[model samples]
Target: MLNVSNVSRVFGKKAAVDRISFTVDKPGFVGIIGRSGAGKSTFLRMMNRLTDATSGQIFVDGTDILALKGAAKRAWQGQCAMIFQQFNLVPRMDVASNVMHGVLNRRSTLATMFNLWSEADITRALSILDRLGIAEQAPKRAEALSGGQQQRVAIARALMQDPKIILADEPIASLDPMNAQIVMDALHRIHTEDGRMVIANLHTLDTARRYCDRVIGMRDGRIVFDGTPDLLTTSAARDIYGADASFSEAATSTSIDTLPRDQNYATTLLGA
Candidate 1:
């Protein structure tokens, strides 16, 4: 459902992504894992044209995303929703209103100018909040909710778009252990039951193993490993993360099994 071919992003002399290529089949959960500055986030941003590639191509449902602009670009972006690590909700707005913002592409300037959302649109937004287990918070101000509730509101907003693909950039990064698991489970359920393509940038190797169908590893702006999570053994992690002599052996020894099943897992395993 998504194909990225030889994509590269250069900032002056530095290449954040260098000729990276990968594909995510329909309804697949693909995880991009790497240490900070390994270009995982850059790669995910390029997939939705949030950050354009300096070279090569990205295709969604067989259409070249780089070739689109203006209305075409906006339309394409609406089909692929993004969830940020911070949740990105408007503090003063209620949850229902925040979710309804996802359909701005479908609303006219006049309708939006008056802050008018149709009954059906509001109903759909409420339904999505319910699906994400945040329906009770719909009438509450976004800032009034907990971190986990805010993330669920973000997910509900994404679902309101009815997107074909979801790009989650460290979606669970800021939550507590239980909240992180809740968000991860919600994302997994979306990929499995809703049959939507999910591409997540994850810091925890264990979360990638448990939730992703395939894991892609990057180092120095290049893809070093692209396969099932089981293929990401001790040696593969060393190849992705090891640099200094002292850290090399220790990095490999700290595999997914040794990591905790909490939000601290990312910090402990990836040292992020």
Candidate 2:
């Protein structure tokens, strides 16, 4: 369970994340939506402890996260896996090696520096890549994969951590619409198959509605709406985007339904 109380992050005169509070007492898929600079990214960073909060507290399973130090803080970070907009893979390294690097935080620095991975770790990494439909690319350099395939590699690396929660900062924002669908489908499958909490920052309303069970809308560092996806109507989205009632929903939609009907397109595109 995750509980955030009055958490805020201020940058000079601006509060990137205001005194925002929310709770996730159950495993589910959550999507955070708003226009750019809505503090969606900052909130996720605070929860991951990448950014310290200016005030208030965050508790995960009843443990005060802000009070943890050193190894305890590192442990907390490990439990909360983060996926960034950029794939963040070592471009020159083979996919398997990059995936094994996920466990480097828990291993000896010297061992990792030499790339001395255990046979079991290698097997596990390959298993994760296979689960994401990229095991064949494990022997190839990270740079050789397509953008979407690279993102899958990134997800495999995150899964290598066996995190209790996954925080994705705009996981599909950089991909083509078809690839975006593929990546979102992978994330949705992970949530359903592992029963883990998945929180993602999404730029489009249709993507959120299609996959997330719950949606949280933030505007100017404050949550303007929080409820089921069905409740995220055009009017609610307008308020979240700070648009007048004349706002067109098309402006915030990615039009995912118009993508190619071929579900295997991602695989074919991978071979391009």
Candidate 3:
């Protein structure tokens, strides 16, 4: 359903996303795993046109997204929703209102200005929150919620858009182990029940292996490996993080069920 062909992003002399190409088909989950600054986030941004590619093209449903502009570009972006590592919610707004913000592109300016979201739209937003197990927090201020609740709110907001594809950049990065599992479970349910295409940028090899059907590894802005998790051996991890004994050791220690999915925990422990 989504195709990226030879996409590259250069910042002056540095190439952030080098000649990468990948395709996501049907409702399956695909994970892009790599070390920090490995270009996973850049690749995700390019998919939604949040960042422009220096060369090559991206196609969604056979339309060239790279060439899209004006209404077309807005339409394409709306069709592919993004969830950042940071719970990008307006702190003062209610959770329901935050979710409703996802529908801004579909609503009239006057309607949005008046905050006059239709009852059905409101119901759908609440329903999505419920699906993510955050419906009870809908009336609460966004800042009052816990980190996990905030992340779930962010997911609900993305679902409110009725997007065909979801680009999640470390969606479970800040939560605890249980919360991370809950969030991953929500994403899994979305993929299985709703049949939406999901591409997630993950830090741990284990999360990629456990949740994603396919894994794409990046290093130095280039794709180093693209295959199933069962094929990702210790040597492959070494290839991606060569001479970095610490990284190799951590990768070796990663177990599909035991790896810490919490990015904050990993950062605090590994000093990454």
Best model per lDDT: 2
Task: Point out where model 3 deviates above 4 Å.
Answer: 243-246, 249-256, 259-272
Q: Which regions of candidate 1 are displaced past 4 Å? A: 243-272
Report lDDT (Cα) of residue 115, candidate 2: 86
lDDT of every model, 2 decimals: 0.83, 0.89, 0.82
- Write the residue-wise lDDT of candidate 2 on 1-272 in tens digits: 88989989999999998999999899999999999999999999988889988998999999989878899999989899999999999999999999988888999988977889999999999999887888999999999999989999999999999999999999998998777877888898899999999999999888888899999999999999999999988899888998863463677778565664336744744542
Least well predicted 10-residue stretch by lDDT in candidate 2: 260-269
Give lDDT for model 1. 0.83
Q: What is the alpha-carbon lDDT for the whole of candidate 3?
A: 0.82
Indicate which candidate wins on TM-score.
Answer: 2
Q: What lDDT does candidate 3 reach at residue 242?
A: 63
Q: How would you encode candidate 1's per-residue C-alpha lDDT over 133-240 as one tens digit per residue?
A: 677788999999888789889999999889999999999888776677777877888888899989999877777888898999899899999999898777778777
- The candidate with the higher TM-score, 1 or 3, is 3
Model 1 lDDT at residue 218: 90
RMSD of 3: 5.3
- TM-score, predicted candidate 2 vs. hidden true structure: 0.95
